[model samples]
Target: MARVVTKPDTLNQLNQDFEQQVLTVPVFLNSVPKCGTHLIRNIFRMFVPVNQQYHDTFIQIPVLRQHVGAFNYLQPKLSWGHLLFSDESAMALRKAQHLVVVRDPYDWVLARARFFLSDNFQGNLEHLKSGQINLEEILNMMIFGIHEKVPSLSDIYTHNAAAWLGTGTKLVRFEELKHHVQNLESDDAEQYFRELLSVLQLREFPTDWRERVRVGSDREQSGTYRDNLTNTAFTLPDQLPEQQRKLVDYAAPGLRNLLGYCD
Candidate 1:
């Protein structure tokens, strides 16, 4: 298994600051890897009681059966994972409200490459992080993937996001989530969150929702937040290069459009 080194967050301690509501149905925050998983998970943590939050592990296919209790509807919990679409996963989440988060493929390529090269990520690809590989090559590896070591952009998005599209899972775009978090005071942001939180089935949106969101979205609290990543040697381009952007399209045709990221 790949190891990710992230600092323990005080969100649990912070979670106590709010009057949390017990969930009636299990709420699963599913996402493509690197699609603001921590940011969304942390925000939901603030709204749910710590006792009801699944702290076991980030549930995935291989170890899913072991942690299937995270989706228990009777003793509801708030859980999150990079779960791919599968018979077992579909069955497990049958009684749970599932939210599948995704990012624009163009930006997702950049995010994936950035993390793979950071000190926080210790995996088989460490050889590529020796500064021997140039930025463009690393970005290409992110798009096409490393032979058997990493799954390609198409593979990840296909099973993780695309396949789950019509299944009753709520699609949450990372870009939209970030925008609302940045403008929480606006009426539009309020409506965005109201709908987002509706899956939780909270009796009523809490009065302190804004403050909870503010603390949960704090960049310092997320270990994987771009600026928080340590020892990222490459100076990645702000946007994917035009050629690489073309490569992304070829790698995952119509992905951006399907995910509502159309130009």
Candidate 2:
């Protein structure tokens, strides 16, 4: 099993600082593995009471059956995970308000490569961290994946994001989420969040929505945040290289378009 080393966040304690509402319906924040899972989860944490938030596990396919109660409509909780599209998952989320978060494939490749190379991630690919493989090779591995080891980008996106579309799951783009968080003072940001949080079915949007978002969106609280990653030997490019970007398109084909990242 792969392990991610993330520092404990104060959001649970900070959540007390706000007047939270009990969730009337279960809410699931599903996403492609590297597509700002914590960012969306953290923001929602501020609006929900601590006890109503599922802290049992990250809720993946393997242990989903055990945590099926996270989606219990009668005991509604705010849960998040990398659940793929399947009969089991579809049934599990049948009674919940589902939100799927995704990032542009071009950028997802970079994020995956960076996380795998960082000391914070300990998994089978730890061998790649020895600098034996060049950055390009690592990036390629992220796209096509290591044979029989990591799953390819297309496989991950197809099941995790694409297939879930048109299934009534609301799509939330990482870029748009981050943009609104960064510009909370603007009317556009206000409207953006109102729409985003609409799935939660809060009786009324809180007056201090901006402050809650600011606290929840803090990069320092995110262990997987790019700058927060530790002992990263290589300096990753701010944008994907043209060659690698083309490789993403080739590997995933219509992925970016399916996720509304491209025309």
lDDT of candidate 2 over 27-57, digit per residue (tens): 9999999899999999999999999999999
Candidate 2 residue 155 C-alpha distance from true site, Å = 0.3
TM-score of each: 0.99, 0.98
| Candidate 1, pairs of clashing residues | none
Full-model lDDT for every candidate: 0.94, 0.93
Compare the candidates by lDDT and give the number of the best one: 1
Ten contiguous residues minimizing lDDT sum, candidate 1: 123-132
Give candidate 2's error at residue 109 in angstroms: 0.5
